[model samples]
Target chain A: MGSHAERKRRDGAQPSARVPSASPAAAHAHRESMPDGAAPAVPGLIRLQPSSVRAAAQTPLHLLPCEIQHNGPAAVSRFFSPAIRPGSSGPVVSFRGRSLHGEEVTLPSGYMGLVLREDKSEGPEDRTVQAIGTFSCFTLWGLEAPPGPNARMHRALSWPSLATAIHAPVAEEDD
Target chain B: MLSHKKRPAEVHCDQWVLVAPESVTDLPGKTENGPVFTRLHNPRTGEAALYLFDTNAQQLFEVKAFHEEFHSWFIGQTVQHDGRLLLVTPVDPLFMVLYYLIKAEKEQGKFQPLDQVVIDAEFPSCSMLLQCAKLRPFLHHVTEEKEIGNKKFYKYSKEKTLKWLNKKVGQTVRALKIGNVNVGARVSSATFVPGDHGSDVKEEDYICYAHGLISEYIPKELSADLAKYLKLPELSASLPEPPLKKRKVSDGPVEAEEDYTKFNRVDLKTKKTNSKMTAAQKALARVDKSGMRSISTFFGTKAKAGK
Candidate 1:
């Protein structure tokens, strides 16, 4: 993962990779060194690669109870994927000796989960994130027992209908 | 517990994994004609927001990214550091146009051609709003129009606009009912199930809730007018604490009173997000909080206490 990401950056094939937290000072310095010499601003809209954005294969995911500090490749398939077993109540797994309770959660209908990739290349125009992938479900892991109604992810998922209610179009003319 | 056949090298690039309307993948025939992403004035707050205009600029979509702390995404073979889930939903383009129309009302304070009223040097692309197909059909909802010598002119009409907005609240109220959204339940945590306890919530609560959602799309002043038009009651003082103070952008030590996705309006590369964060949030933004427990930890304690 890192090698390809690095190769893309080196090859100037920067996609719309979102750099979340480059402090003002660091971004300011980087801006000075940047060849185009402009602020490395995240564009307002991520250009979608129309050619590649078809139905993608279902991607497996795990919502861990604890956060992992690192942000790169891991042997999820080799060490972790094989361990997800169908427990009596739900799926069960263990990582680092702690039992993880899991439940499969699907996004509410009409919504699709996406994995969008971008890069650090410069001289930008229509920067893209076509390493694009999609999913509709993931296994949410909790400690001891899987999260129920109280999980934040569940609450967050409930936001869409409200958003629909909020942004849903009104009549062009009132009777 | 962990094994690596070949650990991948350090990836410097960041990834954005989000949940968007399935229709986002729908592209027009021309590649150059895919959804046009641009910044538009958020009518409610007068702030710039990232918006996408569908091909032909007929429909508007707001990219909403819900955020929580210390979260990241593990894509197929890679890990994305940012954890917020983005959503793109159709938004009424007229709400965006209203920002400019209201501004023109305040500045020129007179009826003007739509083209002249919609101009904004700050967001040069805002002119694209003039091209939206719905602009003509829906312009009458918020404005009074007059035809003179085959040319049509318009002026922002507060009365008409408020009535239109009231209808918006009414429809939203009906939708909340249809969706069984528990409007009375304060979403204080993820464990909050709408119907679980907020069931006895009043009809006023539904109207108020819908009003709040609609308020996010119009100016605060107009939102107040809509509230008056709807005759919605003031937030009763019966709650546990004082109402959250609404602060101006320059005010000091303002709490982040609402959604974390306010970052959607900001340039992601820069850290000075328009976030009016509290000390804890400010600290949270700077810290590297890997290995930290998620909100589920709190759930454990809550369950233990309940048992």
Candidate 2:
């Protein structure tokens, strides 16, 4: 049974290699190589559906939220984190304390974290972590694990508690 | 818990960048590269610092490190950014009025709203006014005329308005050049130059002409010689009415008994003595009586003995 499973895995890998080689450019060249033939004429008797006409019209691209993947720290240093490897399927994991629509989240102890979002909104990006006091780094969901040595030690904190600590009004001293 | 004094070198330039509007993302997820930030040059301090705005974060950051490290000279002058001029000074009523006036002009399509109010209101000295005048001719050439009043009364366009303002300033400078008004003096002199024809004259010549005209207009108290050159009327005719006659009082020897307290003592005593008598008795007593609302009116009748 184990040998059969291994054989199946090897076959699957071979098909994947051939699939990438069938490029659009190669197909186009193959079509050009064929002998010229008279194309079949369309019949005027058939009426085109309005849905087909509508489909031909250009529609503005509607940006939609897709999968979010956690990339390693090397990717994070390059400003790409939890790398959403292209074609992955799952909603992206959002940062805590940051607004969903993109706005600034002031961190405690004068620390400020900026969450960059796909949606362009005036003002700050949503979700923010003002200041994670005494923590080097925090955990994000769906990440395999904290990235290597460089990933600072961070404490996972609730959004509200972090906000309360950061935005707490300063008390005045009696002179 | 690391605390360090933020020095100029320690200032994080990366945090100071100004965010461009379009690079924002729609999802709640984080982006690796945010919008670009630009550092502004502080002319006074000769320092540069970064600026940024994050829409997703809805926060403006002026990175403390930058503020601590750099010397900023943005004290009095206004700063321009993102299609708006940031006024550094506190908004006073006078500034508010001027701001609205400029806003009105902008709404009328005459001037760009974002243009800085270049006129330095602090200490508008004469030298500055003169400098403004030096730029007048160029201003006048660039001024465009616009119809303002009924029957097409021509007025200066924004360019023309600025130009005329510059020329008026130059005229002031020329007027100051002549020995009419001293620098720092509270007083100002007005000059008028006649339109000259058939003469090749430089701009300096116009200044000289203006100076001479202003000198001529100076009040006679300041320059009698200037008054003579202008041939102004010397004096006005006097009125012909005679002075009024004086009145005289007699110095008499009839020697009527002089009782200085006659009215107060005798009259009041007589009135008190006759209080029991009827109204007929008071009417019969011969006291020079007159009804007056106040004591001042009664005493006002008597003049000083010498006068």
Candidate 3:
């Protein structure tokens, strides 16, 4: 996977659609034409668009137990919404002849979860993580019973906290 | 130097729900230094996943996604039918530095400056790890460093690395106690196998869980070594981890697209595989496969993609 494309980037420039090349504008050709220079593009960087970051808010989300293998529109209200029922332990949502148990999982403290949309005009090499929405918690659904601490995601949600300790700066006093 | 460039054949779009530190929002004015998200090889797995470098803060964070089937987001204006919840957390830069030092030991068998040793033609952004201020003080934990004329050259030391990993496991165990993590629950990921967790929790379970967590950052061989060093009794049989190796091949470092001509080509080739998909498959792909990252990443240890 790392063949010729490696060389293309090292050369400092490649013919790509993202470059403002269509205008045939020369480097520094128009300081008068534009006051601020285009942000120097960092190759392979995706940034959070500042304006979009401001738009982040609490968004409702669900994590289904089965893989959908798709990416576009869906009739969630018709097929999925009316199926959620309160069970003894937690919420149970039925779909495809299966009962899915749901539990709420929250992001670790000081971290915000945002639904990001790529600003379409930004090129692949350098793009921005434009936040369309945000969420603090989501329903994590699993088969049979809601996922306990042992569930893949339940354990995954514990990672950031564990990582903090594993990666924390070691105290100098340890012998 | 600004000359005309050619158009890329197609565009790449990524839309995932991301978790980031609050400070990342401060990135608008400072364009020069990025809160840049790039790809780096997962130190343990040698696979590439998206990593974020907030050079402005001189901090490094790793981004991983949590996805399950049939998940979707309901944002303010629309229903984002994607299945990924990306989590970004600060990662110790030393974990990555240790990767290079070990590789350097195998290749050159001698001391070399960090710049020379950490260079990767594929993941050029790996050099950005050097900007992490913690690298200098922490380098000695896993390497033997010699200073000459103000430049430090480093050689790998497994003994020290194991010692450092031991401390990591110890601290992770401590965090587990403080967090009151359900220590007796069955654990997944790392080299450890699934064992019954219904019994009472023991001190060893915490240690085992901690070691499994730390293993996510180091190589499997080194993980075996660390387990031995920690005197962790062999717990269970390790299974064939096919997804990580496959991920390594497909998810090349962020900069290392196999062929640029595929993007730079004048004439675009469009695959009509979508048209052939059954309606259910097509609709499902649209509703379910919204995560920009691969499904393999859903399991968090994809940081190691093992266990």
Candidate 4:
């Protein structure tokens, strides 16, 4: 009987082992004897460490496959060209912002673009968004939304049309 | 005595022409000076030349052009003409349009191009140059609208605001030099406070909370050590233990019932009916008694043979 009781205690002491008790009172007593925050003697509950929660939440999101090649303040300007406007002879797209010297530029066809400028804010709620630039009929190249906290900009461009135009296939398909 | 030496004709390209000034000058000539016009050519292709003219002779004459590889740093950006190096200035498109109009008038003999004009002599830094290029088009667009409104009255669209957030987020994360233990972990979700249905009242008066996640699993102790090394404050408090409960098991009736189950009925039958049985029969009966004893032992009970 002494050996049997000792075996029971040994089995119960394992980290992965679970003890079956007839009464809640006995189970409660058993749990009190365990070290603080240890796994519950009962079967259902799991005690996850706080660090695990933080670690799980910090996982990085997948990055989209796209590259931004240009640099300089006017690097974005390459995407802009003369856009056609009704009853307008020259380039139609006009940039209206504080920094501009007030000029009107026409974009060539097949050029489409957009620009967004956000002011620094103490919080996300206090941030201001300004449409600093835009063009007509541009393609979005990547995912619709930003990937993570690090993704400060989201840009997309049309793919199939651009690809087809750049790489001519042996047989042309009907548009 | 006349010397028989011929000077090289100044290199000129369509749209851009380079002319050496009689003297050095500053950039962006004034309306009074007859600035030296030069021919500028693209080193590559060498196809078209830009016609370069300056109105401010004093500024233009004072500056010298030197040959430097034209780094097409920004598109549609114009720089000052160094002897070979182009020093681009932040020219307002409106100013350019006005300057072009005045030049047209001079061509028609209605006015004279400036002979000697003063210009701002400071050369802009690279960043400043980039800023100028970025802001130029927007200013020109606003001017063309001819709207007489307050300069401070600006409206931001939802799309524009989100785009700004995206850029700022990227910039902040890239700028942060987190320690080695958290290298693969990145900022996952960032929330900004004072957000009104996705709009901000003021840019500066916002609070940003960024959460980062670990990509790989590490031992809990190691992870804790890393967090301690990085000096991250704990966000949650440890919980206290729950109270214990006691149970009372009765000893009288329960003990009697348990003993009754421990006895073997076969042993009682043999004791009552087999007083004169043969040795074989006794041995067989003993085997049956032993089987009952084993069953009782397996359940952690002492076996009782008779009633």
Candidate 5:
């Protein structure tokens, strides 16, 4: 009775394709350039891109200003919420934060990008929102912000004095 | 004449004009004792020479300075064109802006917004573009003005600037090109040779001090070691070991005293009648003070009693 026909049918179904997590270039290169002694290239093995190599190798964990605290065991949600939009100039992403009401509020600007994860298995909860960017513009490149201890502290960029140096007015789309 | 030949260290590595050494001395330029003024040319063509005269010593200094100033932007390889040298340095607009941003921040030791930095770096055009929000997509931290006294100033965050610069440099490097010269070649080509200043000097001296192939004399082993150093992981700063965290000693009782209060303070002088004796007494009690408990104890007799 426990081993029903439905379970058997599910078991017999074909497994889904193995999706690579790395960029297509990196993934393709990984397959082409396998080191003799290294293990078979898994999804997140060695990063070969110069920029990625620098990011992984040069930046020590301590130098990053992000605060990463243990947010208890993870929880799961049914839907996959996308954090970014592919716009004309670049990808735009909203910085998600909890207002005083504990409701999620999306900040309009001043954030680099968002990192969204598909909640496939109803496992643990995670910090799905990774808002990290430069003082200039993180949204342009759709880059993962440097790991931060907290999203709120890292997302803010106020330039009160910058007005003096600015010779031109901000151009609006409608104008 | 062979003895007059200079060592590789004395030879500059930038695009040389192949002039005789005397042309540098003959120029009616700045102070004679100081560095002689020379031309900065396109690394590829050596044809588009900038009239801006830079000091010869400064050129040598700038190469090292560039190594230090924009180490992140520098690719450290050169391409040769028609036997002249050109540095395949990053010429990206983003790179230039980032350089100015970092330079301004470092010099002022304060946060500088895009506008302020553009003015300080003399990139007024870039400043206008920034205000126009042309670079809006790339920027993350810019905000509205905060009025202080009569001045309206904007503060840029260091972390954001740094993050942006790092990403820009990386992206720029990926698409960087230097004419048709092969990537990773030993030396790059120069665009222009200095107009012969009617001096009896070699073109190499006219451009800058460091000469080509003349540096080949550098021991191969030393050069190889240097090459290894260039490839070795770059340390952003030679950070001295962080100063030891200062222990704040106040009028409060010592930490040991606090521990004593946490538990029952055992007095060693007290003759504990139970098994829970003070640690000092326990250790002392474990010692055979009688001395007779030594070898005599093994023999089942005291040393004095045995005698």
Candidate 6:
């Protein structure tokens, strides 16, 4: 029975590769059977809606509550705990603050687990952090950021607090 | 002094001045002598000018009436006619009165209500009397209505009446060259030519009155002009700051008398002298008057023992 289940699992992985290469005619026929074109319900594989994805992408950093700290011997100066990487296009999984010249510093992880890259897409000069990403998580250490400023971190998948977000019911859309 | 060399032939009254009304001419002759060349004295310039007038001209009908009513008599010449004293002149004195009225109107560039008396008094000499007389008939007194106790009073329009009077009098005025320009004098076309008598117009010297200029170093010519320009003569006497306006010291220090009635202390003193009271009543009265005693004093051991 274990050997048969393993074979079924391998078969499922093969069909996923075929799903991308499927012809439009095949998708049309398959869509007619489902009618709604909804993906088959799967655990932990919930497809993010395009509207939700857009909302996540456009979320501003100032909206997030962050830990502020005054480090150094006297604690006279203050700075954000997750060192703000100013002038970045979006949330970058950088380990250090951005220099005055806008180049990311090569310092060791001075930031907390979370990294908030300053959203310079609006006001390029502003230092306020707008979007967020995990700099180094247990599962995401050494993970490279995707190319381009448009790459957005999915909050439901990235944040532990939002673990139940995938289980939340999606309102069925007819069109 | 009268000029006798190549004297210009004297023109008749009709040619030189506005003719008198026919009413004046129709009057019966009262003076034996027709007219005479009378000398009129001008108090302002001391010009003893002569004018030809007859016995009729010396009569006070025109002069006395104008003088007693509104205009001044200072402009009239004193003349003796037929054993009677008269203030008269051949050139109508009213001409000068009108010229001044017109002049005052032009100065402020607005029509002003004027009294005929004020015009005559202000300009007493009539050098341009003949010129003004010729223009006088054209002038008319504008009646202005002023409410006084429900009655409307008529006043002459000083500027408007004079302008209207001189409208036909011809703008050109011819008079003797008297160095000083009169009210009605017009500029002749003749340009001033500097003759051998030095420069008729002296050139003003240039002087720098800027900072660091020394008074002693200033040029003599410029210093004179600067002094004249600034009218320094009036400020020549330094008045030592008027001695700082010393306060007037009189007999003694004056103290204002205090009035006890203002504080009602007089009535309180009278009440104290007139009324008698027991010790308790006196204490109560003291408390009422001064409010300085404590209520604890009234409830003391001695007062309770007495009760």
What would the DockQ be for model 1? Answer: 0.21
lDDT of 6 by residue, B1-307 (tens): 2211210011000000011212222223342222222223221122222232323333211110000000000001110000101111123333334434434544653444334323333223232233332223323432233556754333345444333223212111111011111111011212221121122211111011110011111222323433454343421221110111110121111100111011112223333552332221121122121110111111111111121
Q: Give the TM-score of candidate 2.
A: 0.15
Label model 1 with its docking quality class: incorrect
Residue-by-residue lDDT tens digits, candidate 1, B171-247:
88788777665555343332345455354668776777666667667777887777778777673321111121222
* lDDT score for residue B277 of model 1: 31
lDDT by residue for model 1 over A1-175, one digit each (tens)?
Answer: 1232242243233111222332222211221111222322533344555665564566876666543434666677877778889887798987656687888889988887767655334334434556367789977777667777666677567666666766666765536
User: Chain B TM per candidate, please?
Assistant: 0.74, 0.16, 0.70, 0.14, 0.23, 0.21
Give the lowest summed-lDDT range of ten residues in model 3 chain A: A27-36
- The top-ranked prediction according to TM-score is 1
How do the residues A4-95 of candidate 2 rate in per-residue lDDT, one tens digit apiece?
Answer: 22433443333211111112221112111111132212100111122222222221110111111111111232222343232233223232
Query: lDDT of model 4 at residue B59?
Result: 21
Candidate 6 docking category? incorrect
Deviation in Å, model 5, residue A142 alpha carbon:
47
Question: Chain B, candidate 3: TM?
Answer: 0.70
TM-score of 3: 0.66
RMSD per candidate (Å) reads 10.7, 44.7, 13.4, 42.4, 35.1, 56.6
Full-model lDDT, candidate 2:
0.21
Query: Model 5: per-residue lDDT, tens digit, B138-222?
Result: 3432223355676554444454443333333232222221111111111122111123122333322211111111011122232
Give the per-residue Cα lDDT of candidate 5 at A9.
41
Q: Model 2: per-residue lDDT, tens digit, B29-65?
A: 3343232222221111112222222332232221111
The recovered share of true contacts, given per candidate in order, is 0.35, 0.00, 0.36, 0.00, 0.00, 0.00
Q: On a 0 to 1 DockQ scale, where is model 2?
A: 0.00
